[model samples]
Every structure is written in structure tokens, then in C-alpha cells.
Target: MEKLAASSLPMPTTIIADAGFDSEENYVYAVGDEKEPRFEFLIPYGTSVQEQTRKYKKDIQNAKNWTYCEEEDCFLQLKI
Candidate 1:
């Protein structure tokens, strides 16, 4: 980011990255703290995307089969 800001080239209007670059710090950096963002970004959460795949869904221990209890802020594995 420092390099990009210091460069003489024109600022890009948008940025696209794979799941590998997805992180809270990256998101905050791309979008400035102020009202307006520094640049637009398109990044998807890695886990969310993985969960939709057939391989991930077939796993019995997958989080998708577990229930998230907001009140307890924990995941509950209900017995069958």
C-alpha cells in the first residue's frame, strides 16, 4: 500500500483479489477510515466460499452441520 501511494502512476479505481488476500486489516487499509474509501475492492471470505463446495459440504464435522448459538457465542453440535 505504501508503494502504491508513493508511486507516480494513477490510482486504480477498483481492486480485485483472491481469497488468499482476504483479511480484516487488508479491508481496513483498502477502505480508508474516513467516510469515503480509498478504493473499491472485491474480496470474498475464504471459508464462506469453501463451504459451498461439494467436498466441504460432505464432511460430517463441517461447521455447516453445526448450529451457531448467538446467545452463547459458540457452536453446538446437536446429536442425531
Candidate 2:
């Protein structure tokens, strides 16, 4: 952690993390985003997720089952 902090490297504006880092502790540390402009994190947490998918099952998310965004390279939830 020290290596990542003391490198004088630019922090990412937006970060997407796994559900493992989605706790309140991580959220508090994410306040650093305020210091660094555009430092936003889009971490996914299954427990916090409340979106209902009629077409796709939460257990299995296949590439063909969902729409993809070329820019984000992730599945896009289409509201129909």
C-alpha cells in the first residue's frame, strides 16, 4: 500500500473494483477522490445491488445475454 501511495502517481479518476472492496471502510478511504478531481470509483457489491433483471440471471451473466458498450467494455443494463 505504501508503494502505491508514495509513487507520486496520478490516481484514477474513476475506479471499478470488485465486490471485495465494497465495504464501508473502503468507502471512507474513497474520500480521497475529493482531493483528486474525477477520482470516482464504481465498485460492484452484490449485497448493495437491488436492480432486478428480467432477462439476465444474476447467477450467470453471459456476454450474449446482455448488451455491451464499446467504450466501457461491460454489460449495459437496458431499460425496456
Candidate 3:
């Protein structure tokens, strides 16, 4: 973004990017100073869609699938 801002090319009215470009710094830069804005940003969180899928929900490798053992204070390994 710094390079783009310093470049001679005209700034775009809106900036559309994938999850890879989603970050706090990018958001702040796009918002500009005060109430002004450099451009409209359309970026989604990286896990926005993947977390809702059945594959992600059932995947043994995903931490969310691990069952916590309160007494042992650890996550039980899931058997295939």
C-alpha cells in the first residue's frame, strides 16, 4: 500500500482484495486520516467461510474438533 500510495497511478475509488490482504494496517490506511477514506475495502476474514463448512467442522486436525478434558486439563486425542 505504501508503494501504491507513492506511485504515480491514480488511487482507486474502492479496493477489493481477498483474505490474504485483510489486516488492521490495511484497514487503517484505507480509512485514511480523520473521517476521510482512501478507498472502500472489501475483504473477508480468512476463516469466514471455511469455519462454516462441514469439512472444517469434522476435520480431526482442526483444534475446534478436539474435546477438552476438564479433570486432566488437556484435549483428548480423537481416534479415527
Candidate 4:
């Protein structure tokens, strides 16, 4: 992350990553204050009550709304 921040390449406004890099420390680093370059990160949290609830899962699956990625061969059910 530090290397990327220091690199000459253009930085993106947003970043998406798997659960492995999901943590408070990383969040703080990626989303710094106004003095720093801000980045909006999309990282899924670990399993929790919301994810375990039957109603939540049912709603997500029943919504029939998903964003598919052909390259990754996956579907993302966006709530927003």
C-alpha cells in the first residue's frame, strides 16, 4: 500500500478487494483525512449477524438483482 501511494502511477478513487485485507487498520490507511489522498474502498466484512440472518440472505437471493462480472464469473448483489 505504501509503495502504491508513493508510485508515480495515477491513483484510482476507489478500490475493491477481498475479505483478506478487511480490517480497521487498513481502512484508516486507505481512507485518510483531508490532508491525505482519500480512497473509497469496497471490502466485505467478515461473517456477522446480518450475514447469518435468514431474512437477509433470503432477501438478497430473492431480489433477483445482481451485477455479473464475466471475467471473474461471479455475481454481486448490490444493496445500494
Q: Judged by TM-score, which candidate is best? A: 1
On a 0 to 100 scale, what is the lDDT of residue 65 in model 2? 44
lDDT of each: 0.83, 0.62, 0.82, 0.73
lDDT of 2 by residue, 3-65 (tens): 666789965567788878878767667765455533578878765454455444443444444
Residue-level lDDT for 48 in candidate 4: 44
How does candidate 3 score on lDDT? 0.82
User: Which pairs of residues collide in model 1?
Assistant: none
Q: Which runs in model 2 stand beyond 4 Å of their true positions? A: 33-38, 48-80
Residue-level lDDT tens digits of model 1 in 1-80: 67977999888889989999989999988888885789999988778787888877667687777889999999987643
Off by over 4 Å in 1: 55-80
Q: What is the C-alpha RMSD of each candidate to the true structure, in Å?
A: 3.7, 10.8, 5.8, 12.1
Q: What is the lDDT of residue 5 in candidate 4?
A: 70
Q: Which residue ranges in model 4 land beyond 4 Å of their true spot?
A: 33-37, 48-80
What digit string (tens of lDDT, one per residue) describes model 4 on residues 1-80?
Answer: 66777999888888988878879888878768554737778888775436667766657564444778799999888764
Ranking by lDDT: 1, 3, 4, 2
Pull out the clashing pairs in model 2: 13-38, 13-40
Write the residue-wise lDDT of candidate 3 on 34-77 in tens digits.
85887787988788779888888878988878899999999976
**Candidate 4 minimal-lDDT segment of 10 residues:** 56-65
Residue 5 Cα positional deviation in candidate 4, in Å, after optimal superposition: 1.8
